[model samples]
Target: MLLSIDWIFIIEKCILIAVIIGISLVVAMYETWAERKVAAIMQDRRGPNRAGVFGILQPMADGLKLFMKEEIIPNLSNRFLFVLGPGLAMLTAMMTSAVVPWSSHLDIKGRMVSLQVADINIGILYIFGVVSMGVYGIMIGGWASNNKFSLLAAVRGASQIISYELAMGLSFIALLMLTGTLSLRTIVEQQQDHLYNFIYQPLGFFIFLICAFAECNRTPFDLSEAENELNFGYHQEYSSMKLGFYLFAEYVNMFISSAVMATLFFGGYDIPFVNDISFGQQHGQNVLAILQGLSLFVKVGVFIFFFMWVRWTIPRFRYDQLMRLGWKILIPLALINMLATGFIILLRNNGWHL
Candidate 1:
C-alpha cells in the first residue's frame, strides 16, 4: 500500500525557510542604512537621504551599484577560493538562524504552527555548530587572497574565534545546567513563568554577549578588519560585490547573534505579565501568538540597535588586550559563574534555603 504524505506541511516549511532567508537578507541590507544613519547622528552630520524618501531605497541602490561594478581578481590570488570566500561567509551567517525559535506558536486552522524554521531537539548545539563553522569562511578567504596582511588577519580572526568559542560554550553550559535542556524552545518555556535567565545568569549573559561581539567581529573586537593596520583585513584583495558580501555578512552575523542573545536570555517571546493576562480568555490564542511574535521582534530590534550603538561608540581594542580580555578574564569568569550556579542548584535540591 502507498503511504500518504503531508504536502501542506512541506509547503509550509518551504515558505518559512524562504521567509527567514528573505528576512535575513533584508535585515542585512538595511543594517547598512541604519549604521550610516547612526554614525551620522553620532558624528553630527546628515546621513543618506538622497536615494529615496529618508534613504529607504539606499540599500537597493547600493545592491544595484555593487552588481553593476566589474568583478576584479587579483593577479596572484587563488581564483577559485578567492571567489568562494565571501559566498561561504554569507552562507554561514544565514545558516545560524535556522534553529532559533522566532516566536512561541500559532493556532492555524486547528493545527499548531511553530514560529521557528526548525525545532530540532539539539537547537543550541545546532547554533554552536553553525557558528563555529563561520571562521572557516574567513580563514579560507584570507588565505586565498594571497596577501601577507590578509593571511595575518585571517590567522588572527580564526584564533580569536576559537579562543572565544570555548568561553562561549562554557557560558552555555551554565544555562543548560539551570534549564536542564539544550533545546532553545525548552529554555524559552522555562523562562515564561519566572525570571529570565539574564537575572540568574548575569555573569554568563555578559560573557556570552561579549563573546558574541568577538564572534561576529564587532567593534572593540574587530581586529580581523582593522583597516588602518591591516588594510581592510581579510577581504583586502576583494572588490565590488565580493567585497560587499564580506561586509554584508558581518552585519548579518551581528543581527543573528543579537537575535540569539535575545532568545536565550531575554525571555524569547514571553512578555512580562503575559501569564496574568490570559490569552485564551481575552484575546484568543492567535492574537496572543501574534503579540508574542511582536514582542520577540521588539527584543531583537533593541539588541540590534545596541550592537550598532556599540560599534559607533566604542573604539576597537588593541590585539594584545583583546587576547588578554578573552582568555585571562572572560574564560575564568565564566568558570566561576558555572561553579556558583552549580553550588546554588545543589543547595536548592537539598532544601537549603540560603
Candidate 2:
C-alpha cells in the first residue's frame, strides 16, 4: 500500500489547501485595513498611519487587541451556544472555498496538480446547501445572547437570507441552463478562450450580484447590522476574540463570494482576451499557471473593492425597502432572466441563427 501511494499528488493537494486557507485568512485580515484606507481616501483624511508605515500592520494590531481583551459573557447568556455560534459561522464561510477552482492545473514533474480542494460533480448544489446553513451562525448567536436586540437581528438576518437566496438560486439556474453542468471547473474551462459567462448572462449576473450583496449582508443590504436600531446587531453581546470571529467571518464570506462570482461569471483564472494555452506555449507552464492564479486574485480584488465602495457610497436600506427589493423586484427579474435564457437555449437547439 505504501509503494502504491501517490505521494506527490497527496502532497501537492495538501499544499494547495494550506495555501488557500492561509491566503483567505491573510486577505480577510488586510481587507479591514483596505476598507479603512479606502474610506479615508474617499473622505480626504489619513487613516491608520500610526501603527506601522501607513498602517500596513493595522490588522495584526487589531487582532492583538481583540486577543488581549477581557472575555465577557452575559449573566443570562447560553454559554455553549454563544461560543458555538461564531465558530459555526466561520466554518461555513471557509467551507465554501473548497469547491471553487482557484486556478488552472499546474504541470508538476510528469503529473498534473489541480488548485481546487474538492471538485464534486454537484459543486453548485454543495455551495448552495453550505451557504444556506451559514444563517445558523447568526441565528444561534443572537438567540443565545438572551438579548432582545440580538434576537431581533437574527430574525431579520435569517429572513433576509431566505428571501434573497430564492432570487440568487433562480439567477444561477439560468447559468446552469447555459452550461449544463454544475462543476465549477467545467464552467471555467468552457470559458477559456475569451468566452466569459458574463457576456452571455448579463441579466443573470446582475441579479446574482444583487442577491450576493443581500446574502453577504453588505451595505445597502446590511439591515441585520443596523447599529442605530439594533444596537450593534447580533454580536452586540460578544466580546474579545469571540466578537472578532463574527466580524472576521463577514470579510471571509465577502472574499469567498467574490471568488465564486469570478468563477461563475468571469473566466476564472483565465487571462481575459488572451489565449492562456497559447501563452503557456510561449512562456513556460509554471509561469502561465502563476499568471492565471494572479488573474483570479485580480478579479477577486476588484470585487472586494466594489463591496467596500458600496458600503461607504450607498446609504443603508430600510427594513421594508430591503424586503421589497428582494421579494418584489429581484425575484421577478430573476424569473424573467431564467425564462429568457431558456428561450435562447431552445432557439439555439433548434438551429436558430443570430
Best by lDDT: 2
**lDDT (Cα, tens digit) per residue for candidate 2, span 157-187:** 9899999999999998999999999999999
Per-residue lDDT of model 1, residues 1-354, tens digit only: 486889888888888889888888898889899989988999998899999998999999999999899888999999999999999999999998888887777788888878788888888989899989999899999999999989998999999999999899999999989998888888888898779999989999999999999999999899999998757888888889999999999989988998899889999888777682477458777787778877888888898888889999999998899999989999999999999999999999999986
Q: Clashes in candidate 2: how many? A: 0
Reference-based lDDT, each prediction: 0.89, 0.92
Any idea what lDDT model 2 has?
Answer: 0.92
- Taking all chains together, each candidate's TM-score versus the true structure is 0.96, 0.97
| Superposed model 1: Cα runs more than 4 Å off | 1-5
Q: Which stretches of candidate 2 lie over 4 Å from their true place?
A: 1-8
Which pairs, if any, clash in model 2? Answer: none
